[model samples]
Target chain A: MSDPMAFLLWVKGPMFNWALAIFALGTLARLLEIFLLGRRPNYAEPRGGEWGPGLRTVLTRSVADPGTFQRAPFDVLVGWIWHVGFLIALLLFIPHIELIQALIGLGWPGLPNPVVDAATAVTLVALVATLIHRLRHPVKRHLSTAEDYLIWTVTFLPLITGYLAYHRLIGPYPLALGLHILAAEIFLIVLPFTKLTHIFTAFIARWYNGAIFGRKGVQS
Target chain B: MSEPSIERGLQALRAEIDAPVAAFFSSCVHCGLCAQACPFYLETGDPKYTPVLKLEPLRRVWEREFTLWGRIKAGLGLSPKVTDALLAEWEELLYDSCTMCGRCSLVCPVGNDLQYMIRKAREGMVASGHAPEGLIGAAVRAVQTGSPMGLQWKTLEVQIRHVESSTGLTVPVDVPDVEYLVLLSSMEIINFPEYLEAIARIFDHAGVGWTLSTDCFEATNAGVQIGSKDIAATLVQRIVDAAVKLRVKNVISPECGHAYTAVRWEGPNLIGRPYPFHVYHIIEVLDALRAAGRLRTEGKETDRLSLHDPCNLARKSGVIQEQRNLMDLVAENFVDLEEHGRYQWCCGAGGGVSSNERADALRRAAFKRKKAQIEAVEPERMVTMCATCRTQLEEGLEEFNMDIPVVGLTEMLAEHLVEK
Candidate 1:
């Protein structure tokens, strides 16, 4: 904890491993609980099939439904921006791709460093806007719990720290990188345990919604 | 009935926590976008009306019993428990404020089925004795008598006689192996006998074989609205038994939203078996007859007409386009509400809200959204297929002095039918 170089090494080695282990196992356990609970077989004859509609929903739900865009244009726009930016920065950045390649043996082409940086900057601003909106919007403010704010912080910290580390803006390179990695480790560990689990469960939920509505012959 | 207790409520909640429920709970990030989709929330501007917030008690039970981290927190006395106090607090949110319109389900960013959860949560609420008295009374009458409104077959028989006398067409009774068995809601029987007469004329004109059953004339299921599976099963079984006795190929649910939903969609699941006969909303049958070129129409109404799609018929059971098809045949000057079909705002009297007297004021308040929609369209007459929606529209428009007369789609369609 005292020496910056040694701190970086400890985080990069042991802490990273622990974080990954917890992330994988915790997410697995959460998903297993949902699947194991099992849905009852619907006895009614389906007017339409579930598979096509379910998959369509998985893609279509990414956009706001009709009237939703008109009612909360700000929320819809900002939500799309942050999610798209986050995905670009996470999946298209070189360093993140390298990390994924190292861990899962999956590699893909990464965007330019400047492009990644731009996405990170916009996503950071969107996250801040999201925080403000959550605090100020009556419905969001009322619905939010302490865990919601905590998850927000957990999600925001890693991105901010990573941005700072990439630019080498804080203290020393090793210290900044160490802190960024440490924040990310914390994020990975807390994700499956908090509302952040939506990262995975949202698709499952959308699929179920689509499938049920589809079987009823409704395009939800 | 014995007092419904917290133990039974918790057990009910636990039983209702299936995969979709679990996924919905886990996926909710509390963004509160669902509030924007809700008529009650939009009209009242109450954050408490947020669809996700109404499921708090059920969510607590799911967390405490299902999730690993939740179990640990609960064991350590850190997580919240589902209590009678909480259920009591949510009764209004669950029953009065919500119509189970499924709009919230359609608009949730993460695809959370808030309507489904609310419906499931009502099961727990009823088990805890937190259900509104009006709904409880309706359920009682529904079980003790054949109708939720306590209308006996004698009453429907009177309506049938009137229809027969007026149309000069015989109303079939318990006729075996009919093409369809038509079931009427007490609301339709009491408030709108024209629905029966219209169907009689239409069937006669189309030469469609249909009959009324003496065994289970009532179509509405108070149990489905009350969220009691046992009661729902009993009502559904009666319909199934009647349909079986008559040997009907199909059963046509009258112009009632919940009745169609109960008998067509939820009936099989509630009875734990697939129906031997198929079920259709009256609109669907009429549309099919029209499609088959059997329904010959003579003329269209010149007045401006707009259609109100019942949440159950359009959103819940996918009967949206069928109504629109019927509207096209009967109305020369037809208009649609800005928010129509699957995404339409509820009439605020569905899901037992109309039956629950405690919800009267809230239901009226929620109707403001639909009122605004109707004002925008300014139809000469509002045509809708659901009896509950028709009643609510009539009452709501009258309360607001909108001067709009609500009419049944079937009746209006009958008015345009060609005479042989």
Candidate 2:
């Protein structure tokens, strides 16, 4: 256990279990707390129907509208690149696909190595661009708190370390791999508790806003 | 001296934290898209005026009070406290610079309702005695008198008499079993009595049965602007009780943006029951008449025209297309503003900014966004349905030295009513 390789094994086994437990239970608890708060039912006669706009907004809000796109195209463009690149880099790799298949009995052909390597490079660039943009823009800097910068760093560690391990760009290969797994574990552990909850809540918020505004007859 | 208490303010904020609010705070991605949508931020280049930034105090309160991590942070004295000075500093951000326009809410990638929180934050402002005196006085009058401007029934009666003499039409008062109970804003009663005359002439031509209730004629709720739900509920109760007493089939909210929001949207929620009758914005009623062939206009205005959408009406209430449909009947030369309807910018006065004299400079500053939109189209006249928006546009144009004259959509429709 004193060996670095042995430490990496511990992180992959016991540490993985701990991260998964916290991620699942914490997320469920936070979601329940929000739902239990319960809104006072509105008695106003609805000016428009709800379900149509409510469900529609959950999908529609994925892309910025023309007005919003005009105001900040760079943010939107970088944002989509990061999201798509991260999903491909994380989920479509051969080892990651095998891990999922082992756990959930789901498997698919992984993208070729060169393709994932390109996505890794693009994802890393988008993530760094986001950090620079956040720090440089006055309004973004004003709205940002310690939590925001911290989230950015935590979200960055797994990808950068993974890139380093895959390309053998720096450090010992196993050490980098072990650190990447640890960084991902930390992210999973913190996901349900922090602003990173946006992964789940953003959809619900859009639905609720759409429903309320929809009932008022606005296409939110 | 009766002063607002921190306890009251904190209590109001606590009361506002429901499921949606909690979710909104958690989901906010700090994307800064809302700042781009905010006219105040665009006009002043001030980050503090960002729509989401305006909710800092409220968000602080939510974090420290609601979230586990935030509560832990608070226990360690790590979180910023919502102190008296904090409330004072935020008063302008919450009230003066914001129009509760909902553009930020609409543009948010995560769907955080920044305007909703701003409105909730004002509850804290009012409770802590941090609200601007101009708005406080208006709310006080709205409570004591039937109208916010302290206009009496006699004032309306004189205008009604003048309208009668000029138009040769009776202004029905407290008529039983009328089809519509028309609620007027004091702004309309005081600044634009011609709106009443237009309604009288249009209703005569359209043959819509309606009356003005002396008991609840003023529809704009200062309590809504001031962000006190108790006071707002009282104002809504007056309208509800009057409608029940009058037994009218419907109530008409006229030529006022927030007035319609107050009565049509918030009214039932405030009063705790649906009204026996429905409510409609005057433009919606007119459009319905237009659809039914009950309205006929002699001719279209030859001058080029465009609409300035009031935030509460077009964006918040879904009264977008109805105004455009009505405009088509009387405006042959009408051109839509490039950013018209739901995406339209505010005239920067609807959410009680007009009543708060302190906000005059900031209000005018935000109006530049609308000014640019209107300038691009180069309209001969600006037509809007909301009285508060109309007032803001007229004042904003005058300050900018722009030669455009503004007219109410109802007045324009009245001008073209087919001669009976």
Best by TM-score: 1
> Cα lDDT for residue A158, model 2?
90
TM-score for each model: 0.99, 0.98
Q: Candidate 2 residues B1-420, lDDT tens each? A: 556788778888888888888888889878899999999899999998888878888888888988777888899999989998999999998889999999998888888877777888899889988898888898899889988999898899999999999999999999989999999989998889899999999999999898988888889999999898889999899999888899999999989999899898888889888889999999999999999999998889989999998899999999999999999999899999988788899998879888989998899999999999999999999999998999999999999999999999999999999899
Question: Candidate 2's error at B360, in angstroms?
Answer: 1.1
In terms of TM-score, how similar is model 1 to the real structure? 0.99
Can you write out model 1's per-residue Cα lDDT over B242-324, one digit (the tens) per residue? 99999999999999988988888788999888999999989999999999999989788899999899999999999999988
The lDDT leader among the candidates is 1
> In Å, what is the interface RMSD of model 1?
0.7
* Candidate 2: stretches off by over 4 Å: A105-110, B1-3
Expressed as tens digits, the lDDT of each residue in A1-220 for candidate 1 is 8999999999999999999999999999999999899988889989999988888888899999669999999899998998898889889989999999998899999999999999999999999999999999999999999999999999888889989999999968899999999999999999989989999999999999999899999998
Q: What is the lDDT of residue A37 in candidate 1?
A: 92
Standalone chain B TM-score for every prediction: 0.99, 0.98
Q: Which ten contiguous residues of candidate 1 chain B have the minimum total lDDT?
A: B1-10
